[model samples]
Each structure stands twice: as structure tokens, then as C-alpha cells.
Target: MDERVATALGEAFPERAVDRTFGVGPSWNGANETVGVAFADGERAFCKVAVAGDGSRIARELAVLRYLDAERSIAGPGVLAGDPDADLPYLVTAPAPGRELLGVWEDAGDDENAGEVEREALLRRVGATLATLHAKRFETHGEIVGTDRGGGLALDPAPWPDVLRATIERTREIGTSERLADHYDAAFDCVEATRGRLEGAPAALLHGDVAKPNLFVSDGDGSDPAVGPDGIVPIDWELAHVGDPARDLVRAEDQLLNGFDSEGPARYADALYKGYRDRAGGLPPGFAERRPIYEVVRMLGRSGFIDQWVTYLDEPLESLVDRADAELRARLDAV
Candidate 1:
């Protein structure tokens, strides 16, 4: 066990000894570690510790979880013990039942029809879960700093355009490929020209990464007999932020649909929209018009690391860039 985990176990649960520890979930390269701990008293818990970074990421996650726990409507893990401010920040919580949505989705991998049925049902729950998330109010949009005195996030709100430009610029820099570095300036121009679509966007809570792995499916074995329509639980709030709800929802569609396969069924998208629309009342004013642009934005972020996975593709990196470049222009033209 890492010193941080060993020390934390002694401090948090002095009576219980560490049974075993294993790598549990997805983690950024050096940023954090999700560890599973089983105790002598027959209790099991999950702990997330930030081994690197300035602590803001894990701290934000803790704050978000606390807020969700306060709301009590979203079905997620409850914060049993944590110290986001500690030297090696760690959060301990009891695990929710079932498994990751990706694992559940993969069960239908061999059977096409089964995948379709499961995906549609799961997408609907994801949609409703997003509705529950978007219901949490924030005064404005930007990075979440910390908890405010009012038991809400201390937000540093910025104009939506500025946020969009800043994010695009950062992604370009993060892409870090000398081959494509010079061409990214035009991406900035696209955002600069297309800022009108994002103007005056309302701020709301966003589960920044809404892919299959980060979401969980519960059997709903508690007081609620049925798993119900909202059994999906979104985990991993490291990317959670305050932003335009449309941007979040659109990115979610792009992520959840394209995560496993390039072409996911349209009915799954329909199911997701039905869940969000029935709950939120309607789509954002310009979502249909602005969706293509956001799809390009999401594509840019993914393309940044294409070289890492380029080996799997039959075509060269240059080919993917060519297609992405054309798609970018098309999205911009539509705007």
C-alpha cells in the first residue's frame, strides 16, 4: 500500500485493519488512485486519493460529491470519510451495487440485437440522470473553486464565449503534436467567428465526463424495489464544472454514443433526448443548430491524442487530420 493509503486507513478507521488494496477504476496518469479496501468487520469501501496535482481536482470532486449527497436525489456513493484538504487528499465511500455501464454494455458485444435493447434502456437512464444533474443550479459558468458559505460551489463565472475560447486554446496546446501544432490557430478563428451560438448560455452543473466507464448501474435493492428509471449513477467528478448545459449534454451525446463503436444507434440518442426533454421540459434554444459545432469541439479534444492510438488505425495520422479538418470546416460552415 502507498504511504498515503496506509496512513489514511489508520486515521480514518483505526479499529479496522487493511485487508487488501487493488487498483479499482480509471485514473489520470499520475493524478489520482482509486483503491478498494475491505475491512475486518466485513465492510467494504472505495477510496480515491490524489497522489499528484495541486489538490484542486480531487478537492473539486469532494465538494461536488458533498453537494450531491446534500441533494439526496441523485443515486451515487455517499461520502463516508474523506479529507480533500489533507496532504495526500483521499475520499472513502461505500460502493454502489451492480457495475460500470461499460461492463454492462459489453455483455451485448456478441449479440447485436441485445446491444441495441440494452443501450436504449441504458441511454434513457443516462438522460434522466443528466436531467437530475442539470437541475442543480449555479449562479454562473466557469471553474468551480470551492464551497461557498451558502452550501454551494464557489464559482468563478466567465462569459460563455471566453470560456469556450480558453478551453479550445488549451486543448490545442494540450494536443502537443508538432506536426499539427501550427494548424490549430484556425480552430481559434472558428470559435471566434462562431461565438454567437454560445452567447448568454445559462450555467448549470455538468458531469464533465459522461462516458460509459464513469457511469454506474445499480440494481436498486434499497427501499426502492425497482431499479427505476433513474438507476444510473455518474461517478468521477474530476472533470465536473459549471458550464452551459447544452454544451454538457451535447458532449455527453458525442461521448456516450461514440465511446465503444463509431456508429451507435439513433434510438439510443432518442431515448436520451426523451429522458432529458421530459425532465428539463425542452431542448435549449439553439441546440440543434449549435450541436454540430460542439461535436467538432469534442472531436478536437479527442484528436489531440490521436497519435497515441494511431497504431490501431489502418490510415496514417495525416489522414485522420484531413478528415477532421474537413469536418471542422463543415461544422463551421453550418454555424
Candidate 2:
């Protein structure tokens, strides 16, 4: 167990004994650590603590979970205990109900998982779920600094472009290394140059990182027992914020379908978008116009985490670096 996690569990459950701790899975964010905990009395929960002693992510997640619990109909993990301001900031929550969407999506190729048909339905549900969340509109865009007294988001208001740039800075804080340092500069330049196009975007709540691993679906074979009305539940709200719905949709498609070496099958991407379109009454406004810049921004996910990608792909660092460089440049040129 991580020392911080152990300390947090001790604080959160002063009267109980812990039976064991287990790994949740690989996470790309380097600032925080999360683990699944089993108590001696038989209850289980997940504990996340900031390893760098910076509590912003903890605060963001805690506030988002509280907001979801109070306002949103969708199911999110119930907060068990947390204090983002503590010496060792941490948040504990009951485990999200269901299996990870990553496993189900990956196993869709297998005969037993009912193949691409099932996977397509899953991605569609993902798109619809995002649409449901994005339907909650905000008057202005900004970072979710915390919650208001009324149990709503306390946003530090900024223009949409500034808010988007702030997210890039936050990603840099958590994931960037010296190897692709210039890529960050280039991304900033791209966002700055496209400021005119990015203004006046719809202000909807976006799950900034929409990777399959952050989503969950019920264990039931049918969709009826799914965690939320849209038949999917999302975890890890640290990146949640108010932003352009189109940005979230673009990120969702990329995160859900793209691979290290290539973009995954086009049909799957289509299915995901189709689901979003079916729910949103068409794609979010400006989806096509703003997509290129968002694509340029999304390149940071690869460039900023090149080393992790090298390990994830089990390929030579030099080769991955070359590929990521080429890809980032290509995306910038497209914008």
C-alpha cells in the first residue's frame, strides 16, 4: 500500500482494520495514486491520494462527485470520506458498480463476447451517456474550482479559449516530460491562433478524459441493469469541467477508439458518433468546425506521455518518439 493511502485509510476509518489493498489498473496521471481497499469487516472502497501533496485534483474530484450526487441523475461512486485540504489529501469512495468498459471493448473481438456488434452497442451507449451529461448547460465556461454553497459547481469564470488552454496547462503539470517539451509550446500556439474560432462555444460539462478505462458498464448481459439511464457510468471526475460539448465528443471518440500505432476501425468511430447524434438531436453545435483544433490539442495525450506510450506499445523509445513527433506535427498542420 502507498504510505499516503495507508495514512488516508487510517484517517477515514479510524475504528476499522483493513484486510488488504490491491492495484486498480494503470493510470497515466503521475500526480495521484489510487488503490482498491478491502476492510476486515468486509466492506470495500477505493482510495486516491495525491502523491505530490498537491490537492487540486483531489479537490476537483471530490467537488465533482458531490455535485453529481446532488444534481445529476447518472450514477457515480458514492463518496465515503475525503478532505482535499488535509496534510495528505485523499478521497475515498465506494467502488463504482460494474466492470470496466476497457475490458469489454477489448474482448469484443473474441467469440464469447459477441464480437463487434456488442462493442458497437457499447460505444453507442458511451456516446449517449456523454450526451446526457453534456445536456446540463452552464452560462459561462471555467475551471471547476470547487462546489458552491447551493451544491452546484463553483466555477472560476474564463472565456472558453482560456479555459481550454488551462486544461492543457493542467495536463502538462500532471503528464509532460522534457522529451516533447516543444510540442506543448506548439499546442499553445495552435490554441492561441485559433482563439477566434473557439470563442462562444456551448458551455456544457465535459469529462475531460473519456478513455474507456474511466467508464463502467453493468455485469449484466443485457442493458437493462446498467448503472445509469444511458446504460453506462463514468468514474474519475478529476478532469471534469464546463466546456464545449464538441470538445468532449471529439476527445471521447479518440480515447474510445484510437490505438497507439493507428486509429482503430472507422466503423466503431461511426457508431460512437451515431450514438451521440441520436441523443443530442444531431452532433453538438460546431462539432465539425472545432474538431481540428481539438485534434491538435489531443496530440498532447501522445506527445506529453511518450515514455508511457513506449512502454504501453512495447516498442523502441526512438521509434515511438519519431512517430509521436510526426503525428503531432500532422495534427498542427491540419489546424
Candidate 3:
């Protein structure tokens, strides 16, 4: 444990003695850096601390959780207490139940038929949860958090395009195979062509990162031994913002398609559209036309040459860049 974390916890709850416990389970989510520690009272909680000056991230997360807590419609980790004044901004919350959907999907592994069935059910649950969130009157903590009247949270949109461009440049710089090179080129072109179209889309409250890992499931103890059907609990609202709803939906769709190999891309893509429509009432105009472009944007946004693809591939950086270039070219051809 970092000495800073221990001291911060002591200050936050001055009356209680804090002991580090090894028996506590590890964190199952990826939203932020949190240490899993069991308190002396036998309560298991996650301790999330941010450096004092970097309180915005923790503040934003706390605000979202507080807003959700008030609504009481969705299942999320309940915030126990938080303080931003200490050397570390800290929050303690009861852990929510569920296995990360990515792990579940991976465990289902190459069992195609079984994976497809499970994936569909998971998709429906996710769709329903999202629908509930979107249906609520756009209110949060009784204040409008954005320019829109819906009270959705706001974030500067200026960084997204630059973020996308930097991702592409990084991938290209890393270098990869001919095939990936082609794909990267094609993806870049698609981005350039459709960038203008997305500018006009209406902004709504979006779960900034809606990938599979953030969707969790818990199982009920029963003879059936299957995962509970109440639906997935969406975790991590740190990136929640008033932005293009399509960005959120498309991000989820891309994860279901490209990130998971259990089902064919087109099949999963169709399933996502169906799920989104069931909740949102209808697809946005030109949804089909815009999907390919959005996929490119999402791919670029997620590509971290050093952290994810290149390191996982265990190849030379130049080779990784080459592969990305080829993949972009191929994706562009399809577009």
C-alpha cells in the first residue's frame, strides 16, 4: 500500500483504526485506480484516491454517483464517503456485484453457439439498462450540467478530433504489416470524409466508455446456476458527459463486434442496432451510413500503440505500425 493512501484514509475517517487486509478481493472494474481494502469492521470497500490537485476526475465521478444515487433507478456502487481536501481526494464505496462481462465473454471463449446465446442475452440486458438511463428526465443533482436543458453533463469536445489524429499518427509511427497498413489508411480516409457529418448530431448524456469490460453481471444462487437476469450494472461514470449519443452507442457496438471474436462482426453489429432501437425507439437518420465512419473513429480513439496492441503483439514497434497501416487500408476499402 502506498503510504499516501494510508495517511489519507486515516484523515478521512479519523475515529476509526484502519488496518490493511490481504484477504480482500481485487478490483473487478477498470474505471480508476482503487485499492481494495477491508475495514476493521469487516466491511469490504474500494478506496479510490486522487492526488489533491487532480481532484476534477474524482469530483466528476463522485458527482455522477451522487446523481445516480438520487435517481435510484440504476444499480451502482453506493458512495460511502468522500473528501477532496486531503493530499489525496478519496472515496469509499460498497462494491457492486458482477463479473466483468469481458471475462465472462472470454471464458465462454471459442464455444461459438454458447457464446452467441450468452452474448445476445447480455446485449439485451445492456440495452434495457441504457434505455432506462436515457428515458429519465435529463436532470442531475437538480442542476443543468450542460448547455442542453436536459441537465446532462458537459465536456469540452475540442480534444476528441485531436485525440483521434494523435492515435492514428502513433499507430503509423509504430509501423506494422502490409495488411494493417492498408486498413489504417482506409480508416483514416473514412474519418476525414465523415468528420463533418457528425458535427450536427444532437448531444445527450453519454456513458463515455461503454466497452464490454464496464458491463458487469452477478449470478443468483439457484439450481439453474446461470447468471442473474435482472440485467447488467453499468459501472464507471467518470467519463459521463453530454456528448453525441451515437458515440456511446457506436463504442458499445464496436466492442461487441471487433473486440469480441465470439461472433461474426456483421451479426453482432446487427444485434447492437436492434438492441439500441428497442430502447431508443429508432435509429438516428443515416445510422447505417455513419456506422463505418464512427467505427473508424472509435478504433483510433482506443488504439494505444504502447499500452495495448503493440505490447500485446510483442513485436517491434515498426512492425506494429505497419500492421495498423494495413488494417486501416482494408477498413477504408470496406467503407
Candidate 4:
């Protein structure tokens, strides 16, 4: 147990004996320090606290959770209690229902009866859940308002080009294998060439990070049952901001396809777009033509940054470079 977290929980819930258990369960984003914890009073809840610098992120997440809880628009974790004054800011919320879709997919792969059906059901639910969130209207957030679908609060897109350029340069400054170097250079070129095309695209209220880990799914199993009238529940609003809807779609598609063959990519892309169109209005004008470019640019920018941190993790840079290269190739083919 983190001493700060322990003290914070103890102070916040003085009446209950809070026992922090160390294990893996689920999280909204990466802000939560303690993984799985069981409170002494038999309280079923999860805790997320900001570390050193940005307590505001945790605060913002708590605010969003509170708003959602009040509206009851979607099924999300309920706030049990929290302490902002602790060494680290923290919030305790009753655990939301359902297993992460990734876990479900992995488990179902081995299951005999519910493999394919479960996977498809989870995917559709994910699509529907995103639509629900995107469909809502908001009066105010940090800096933006209105549920324009593309015009919610978000990190400034103005500096993205420069940020990406700097990230690429920094990756080259650090050591990279020859194969990675070639891929990096090629990806950079693709981004630079397509920069103008993406800069002009419309933005929306995006989940910020919409990958599999952030997505929660339930096939009506376990204590956290699957969403009933609603579908999947999109949690983790830390990165939620007004940004390009295409960006969200791309991220989701990448996770769904998982760098598989071109066939899988196409299938996932088609299914995702169809679902998006069915729920939201039609795809943004010229979305199909612009998607490949946007995806390559975003992937290059992301993978390039991640490559700089490869020293800390065991992830192979070659795989990231390969994916970027494939996305780049697709972009070129599309053009």
C-alpha cells in the first residue's frame, strides 16, 4: 500500500477500516496508483490518485464522474468519497460493472461456446456506448462547451504538429536501430506531407485515449453486469476533450484490429464506420478519404514518442515501426 494513499483513505473514510489490497483489476486511465484494493468494511470500490505534479487531472476526472453519477445518463463508478488534501489527491468510487473488453476477448478466445458471439457483441456494445457519450450535450467544461460531437473540451490541437516534430527529433537523438531509423524517417515524411490535410479537419468531443484498455465491456456476466438499455460504458475522462472524431475512431480501430493482416484492418474499419454512421450522423464529409492520412500521422506521432521510452519497457520498437510503416503504406496507396 502506498503510505500516502493509505493515510488519505484512512482520513477520508475514518469510520471504515480501509485495507488496500495489492493486485490487478481495472482502472479508468493510468492515474490510479493502487490497483485492486478491498476495504476493511467490505466496501467494493476503486481508488485513483494523482501523483506529484497534476492533482488537477484527478480532480477533473472526479468532477466528470460526479456529473455522470448525478445525471445517471450512463453506468459509471459511483463516488464513495475522497480527499484532495492528502499527500496525493485521491477519490474512491464503487467499481463499475463489467470486465474490460480486452480481457473478455482473451478469455473468450479459449472459451468453447462464447468466442465469436461474445467478441462481436462486445464490439457492438462498444460502438453503441461511444455513440451515447458523443450524443450528450454539455453546458461547460474546463475551456469548452456544447456537444458538437467534434467541439467538446480537449487538449489544444494547435501545437500538435510542432509537438510531433519535436518528438520525432528527440527519438532520433536517442539511439534507434537502423530498421527503426528508416521507418521513423519515412513516417516523419508522411506526417509532414499530410499535415495540411489533417490540420483543417473538424474536431469533436473525443475520449482522448480510446484504446481497448480504457474501454469497459460486459457480456452480461459477473458482478458488473453488461450494460442493459445502454451499451458499453466509456470511462476515463482525463483526456476527454474536443478533438477530431476520426482520431477516436482510428484509435479504436487500431486496438480492434491489433496490427493484424490487411483483411482484419479493413473489416474492423468497415464495421466501425458502419456503426458510427448508424449511431451518429453520417461520417464527416470526406472522412473516408482523409482517415488513412489522419491515422498514419497520429500513429507516427504516438509511436515516435513511445520509441523514446523503449529503454524503460520491453516493447519492441520494430513492431511499432512496422505498424507505422504499414499505415504509411496504406496512406500512400489511398492517395
Candidate 5:
């Protein structure tokens, strides 16, 4: 129970009394804090108080929630109060329906083969949701409020390839190491040298971080007990941006089906792609050509942030980066 939670809630919901609160979220490890709260008046809202480094994320998420709820019929959290510029930036949102998809996944974790049908069904819905989001179009790829999306100078949209290159470059800087930066540089160069492939990447909505923790499932507004196509609701839009949909799809697969190692059978990914195709009428143009490129780029970005993903490394940063380099080369060759 961090004291910041109460402070942010008090500021946001001065009218209601905050009560019975506990920490919630994947990053509750101290860097960023989120709490599920129940007020004295029987109302509930999710609270997120961003640490200094996470102010922009909180701001972006608040804006994204407003955009989706107001403009799109997406059934995700709605912003109740926000102070993006506050000393400890924070936002409060009405609890969207359904349970966290991670919990559902965990119930089937002990046995990978458990609930195979159920698991694939959920993945299909996740895919359909992605298809639904892809419908929200933008002229150029970049931030939602970018000049391309008709906003002030806060963000300015650019070509898809340009944004992809910029993201890889930024990730490299943020995750640089003398021992590994060189290998990382090679991966970046390959992507740039073959950047012509990205021309087919479309400027579409991307649910920046499409991990299990960010998805929700419910029958409906507490009306029934069934999880189906419309039951799928994705939360956490802080990373949401206008970018290549293929890049987004690959990242989603990384979290949903496989990671860098890619050991497990990609059944979930297959179902997700099928659902996406069924909804979109067909896969995007040049999908086969761009998928691996985006996967390689995603791997490079993940390689940069070793500390964040070290849990999966099971080895020193040196070995992991060595492995990342090899993986990058292999994926590039496959492309």
C-alpha cells in the first residue's frame, strides 16, 4: 500500500472516500503503481500514480482512454479524473467489465495442454479485437494526437517506416551496452538497409503493449456470463500509437504466444491471425514480407531493455545479448 495511491485518489476523487484499496498491475514492482479501489459509496475505479519517469505514459493513457471511449465504442476503462501535470502524475478510471485475461491464462498454466479449446477461443477473440481496432484509421503513422491526427504540436505523425526506424534507434540508446551495442547496431542497420519492405506497413492503431495483463474479458455490462467476440476488451493504451499494424501484430504474438526463444508451438498465434483475417476480410498486403522484419525489430527493442526482461534470460547480459544477436541474425536471414 504505497502512500502515493491514497494521495492520488484523494486528489482525483475528493468527493468520495477512498477505502479498501490494494496494489494492482504488472509493474507494481515500484517503478509504476496502480491500484484497484473501492470507495465508501460503492463505486470502484482503477488508480494509477506514475513515478517521475512514467509521467508521459500516464498522460498518454489518459488521453487514449478518452479518445477510445468518446469516439470509438470500445468497452475499456473510462477516465474519471486525471492530472497529467501533477507533481506525481495520476489518473483514475471506471472499472471496465470482465476479469483480467492473465488470470484466465494462469488457470490453464499448470497444464499447457489444459483447456486447449478455451485457450484458442480466447486468442481468436483477441485477434478479432485487434481487427476492430485496425478499423480506426489515420492518415500518417505516429502518435494519436500527432499533427497527422489533427492535433497541436504535442505529436506529429510520420511515415510508417520512419517511425519504426526511430523506435528501434531510441530503444538501442536506452538499452545500450559497450559489449553489445555493436551487435545491436548491426540489427538496426539491416532493418534500415531493407527499409523498403516497410512501405507496405499501414498507418493503423496499435495497442502498444498487447500483453495478457492488458486484456480483459466479460460477457457484457455485468448482464450475462459468457465470453465471446465482444467480450474482449484491451486496456492500457499508454503505448497506443499510430504505426504499422504488422509491427503491432508481431508484438502481440510475442506476448500472447511466444517470446524471443519461440520454443512453444504457435497455436495461439495461428488462431489470432485467423481471427484477424476473418474480420479484416484478408491479411494486410505484403504481410509475409513484413512480419519477420517487425519480429526482428521487436527482438532488437526487447534486447535493449535487459533489466526489464532479465527474468527470461536465465543468463548474464553478455550471453543474453550474444543470444539476441544470434536471434536477430537468424530472424533477418529468415526474412
Candidate 6:
């Protein structure tokens, strides 16, 4: 354990004695470190610390969680304690509602038909949860600085394109942007070229990172073991922002369904979209028109992190680079 985590645990649980600390799961974000804490009296909680000494992410999450609690837009883990201003900033939260979506999806087994059906049902629920979050509309898109007294987001207003560009710039702070630096330039150019189309997109609360690990399956009723009435509860709100719902949906589909090269079964995409359409009347207003550019922008996830991909997929670095380069060109061409 890093010395910072120990200090944060002491700060978060000043009165209680910590019995043990355990790993939460795999997390690729180098900016933060998380651990599951077990207290002497048998209570368990999760703690996330900003190891990089930048408290902005912790502050953003604190603001978003408070906003969610106040607005009741959707279910999220209740924040037990947090202070982004602390010397070693940390957040401790009560356990999320149910099993992680990744664990639940994996447990379904690979029996093809049965697995796909179960996965589809879970994806539908995720779709509904996203819709609920995105229902909160803003006239202009901006960076969420904190919460207002009335429980609304206090945003630092900016154009949607600028806001999106800021998010892309985050890859640079982490080491990913350094790996394929040119992709960053290309993504910026693409965002600039499509600035007009991205200008008038509907602004809503977006879970910027919508992967399975960040989502949990609520313990619904006995009928469907995977999904509950509350739908899927999302955690890790540090990435939450006010952006285009169409951009959010595009990201959700890519994160949830697509794999390397942005390839995945068409059926999975269909089920996911159907769930969103079922709730939102149809896809977000500009989904179809703006999707190609979003796809182009999404390539940064691959291009910027090719090194991690080599380890994750256990392939040679050279081979992964070649594939990523080809895939990136294809996406850029599409845009």
C-alpha cells in the first residue's frame, strides 16, 4: 500500500480501527488508487485516493455524488466521507447496491444463446439507467465545478466542442496521450472540423466513463436475477460532465459493446440501442448525424493506450500498433 492511502484511511476513519485493506479490482487510471477497507467491527467500505496529488478528480466526484444525492436522478453509492482539499485527498463510500456488471456478465457463461440473452437484458437495464441520468438537461454545456445551493450543478460554461476537447486533453496528463501523440493532434483537428455539428447537441449529465466495472446490477426482484427496479447503478462520477447526450450514448455503446478495432456483434449494439430508444422516445436528437465523428474521437482510447492493450491482449507490441494504426485510419476516414 502507498503511504498516501494509509494517511487517507486514517483521515477518513479517525475513530475506527482498520482491520485490513484489500484490492478492489483492476483499474487502469494512473491518477487514482482505490482499496476496499474492512474495519475492526466488521464494516466494509471503499476508499479512493488521488495518488497523483491532483485533487480535481476527487473534487469533481464529490460534487457529482452530492448532486446525485440531492437530485435523486439515479442511484449511486452514498458518499460516507470525502475531502478533495485534504493533503491526501480521499473519498470513502458505502458499498454499491449489487454485483458488478462485469462479474454478472461473465458469470452468465459462454453458451452463446443463453449468454447473449442474459447479457442483452443487462445491457437494456444499463441503457435505461443512462437515460435516467441524461434526463437532466442544461441549456449550455460546461465543466461541472461543484453543486449549487439548490442541488443543481454549478458549471463553468463553455461551448460543447471546447468541453469535449478538454476531456480529450486529459489523456495527455496521464501517459496515454504521450504514446500516440499524433492521434491527439488528429482528434483535435477532427473536433475542430465538426465543431458546427457538435455545437447544438443536447446538453445533459453524462457519465464520461461508462464501462462495465463502473456499473452495478441492482438486486431487483426474483424474476430477473440480473436487473432490479432501480436499474443499473453507476459509480465513479469523477468523469461525470455536462455534454451532448448523443455523445454520451455513442460512448456508452462503444464502451459496453465494442472491442479492439471497434468491432462487436451487431446484435449487442442493437439490444443496447433498443433499450435507450425505448426510454428516450428515440435516440438523442443528433445521434445519427454526429456518430461518425464521435467514433473518430473514440479511437483515442485505443491509440493512446496501445501499450496497455499489448499487455491486456497478450499480443506483441508491434502487432498491436499495426492493428491500432489501421483501425485509427479507418475511423478517421469514416469521419
In terms of lDDT, the best-performing candidate is: 2
CA RMSD (A), model 5:
3.8
lDDT of 1 by residue, 72-185 (tens): 667567677877777777778777656889888878545888778877877877887788778766666787767778877777778777777666665664463545553456
Q: How accurate is candidate 3 locally (lDDT)?
A: 0.57
For model 1 the TM-score comes to 0.84
Model 4's alpha-carbon lDDT is: 0.56
Poorest stretch of ten by lDDT in candidate 2: 219-228
Q: How much does candidate 6 score in TM-score?
A: 0.95
TM-score versus the correct structure, for each prediction: 0.84, 0.95, 0.71, 0.69, 0.84, 0.95
In Å, residue 230's CA in model 4 sits off its true spot by 3.3
lDDT of 5 by residue, 106-203 (tens): 67545656667678887877888788778766677776542224332145567777777666664564563445556556666767777788765777
Off by over 4 Å in 5: 1-3, 28-31, 108-114, 146-155, 169-184, 220-229, 308-318
**Which ten-residue region of model 4 has the weakest summed lDDT?**
139-148
Q: lDDT of each prediction vs. the true structure?
A: 0.71, 0.86, 0.57, 0.56, 0.71, 0.83
Which residues of candidate 6, in runs, are more than 4 Å off? 221-228
RMSD of each: 3.4, 2.1, 6.6, 6.3, 3.8, 2.4
Model 1 residue 180 distance off true place after TM-score fit, in angstroms:
4.0
Q: What lDDT is reached at residue 297 by model 2?
A: 88
Task: Give the distance in Å from residue 300's predicted Cα in candidate 4 to where it truly belongs.
Answer: 5.0
Model 5 Cα shift for residue 24 (angstroms): 1.8
Candidate 3 regions exceeding 4 Å error are 21-32, 84-86, 107-112, 136-196, 219-230, 256-265, 328-335
Clashes of each: 0, 0, 38, 9, 1, 1
lDDT of 6 by residue, 191-277 (tens): 999999999899999989999999988765534312334568789988888999888888888988888775578888888878877
